[model samples]
Target: MPDRPRHYLRQQLRWMRGTTVRHLWWLRHMPLRSLGFWMPVVEYPHLVLALLVPVAVLATP
Candidate 1:
């Protein structure tokens, strides 16, 4: 676990970036019938929500 909020956010960003890159690569290289082609549907929405939660929390006054 991260020792601070900044570290946690940085880790989440890294995970999000890696997941996005992996999805892009899968879209380019994987067949439509493969699990890789379908993984983003399972994973991407959660990542977007993870991203949004932090932003929402920070945006609140």
Candidate 2:
């Protein structure tokens, strides 16, 4: 392959890698942006705690 095309391809790959890094960085700290559905469930602690007791009892040794 020619040098210019190979260099361009490498640059494009680098740009893609940079974009992927930025996306992952955002995901690591900005959890709500990715998990909108899960946020509501987390807000209701009492209901969750009530349900967990039965499930835990069922699974106990």
Candidate 3:
């Protein structure tokens, strides 16, 4: 595995962690039902994009 992509991914995850904490703090201010749909929408894409971008780039021949 290339170190660069993995390193980049780690950075992304770190950013996502901070973003998630901040976002969840805001989410707590919203209604419960709003959280059910919105949390996954905001969170999953960050995690997936963080993983997907590095893999797709690293996987390139």
Best by lDDT: 1
Better of 1 and 3 by TM-score: 1
lDDT of 1 by residue, 1-61 (tens): 9999999999999998997898899989989999988888668788789999999999999
Top TM-score model? 1
Residues 1-61 of candidate 2: C-alpha lDDT, one tens digit per residue: 4369888899889997896576566556666755643444454566678899999999999
List the candidate 3 regions with Cα displacement exceeding 4 Å.
Answer: 1-3, 29-61
The per-candidate count of clashes, in order, stands at 0, 0, 0
Residue pairs in candidate 3 whose N, alpha carbon or C atoms collide under 3 angstroms: none
User: Model 1: runs farther than 4 Å from truth?
Assistant: 45-61
For every candidate, C-alpha RMSD to the true structure in Å: 5.2, 14.4, 7.8
What's the TM for model 1? 0.64
Global Cα lDDT for candidate 3: 0.78
lDDT for 48 in candidate 2 is 76
Question: What ranges in model 2 sit over 4 Å off?
Answer: 1-3, 31-61
Residues 25-53, candidate 3, lDDT per residue (tens digit)?
A: 76667666786548756777888899999
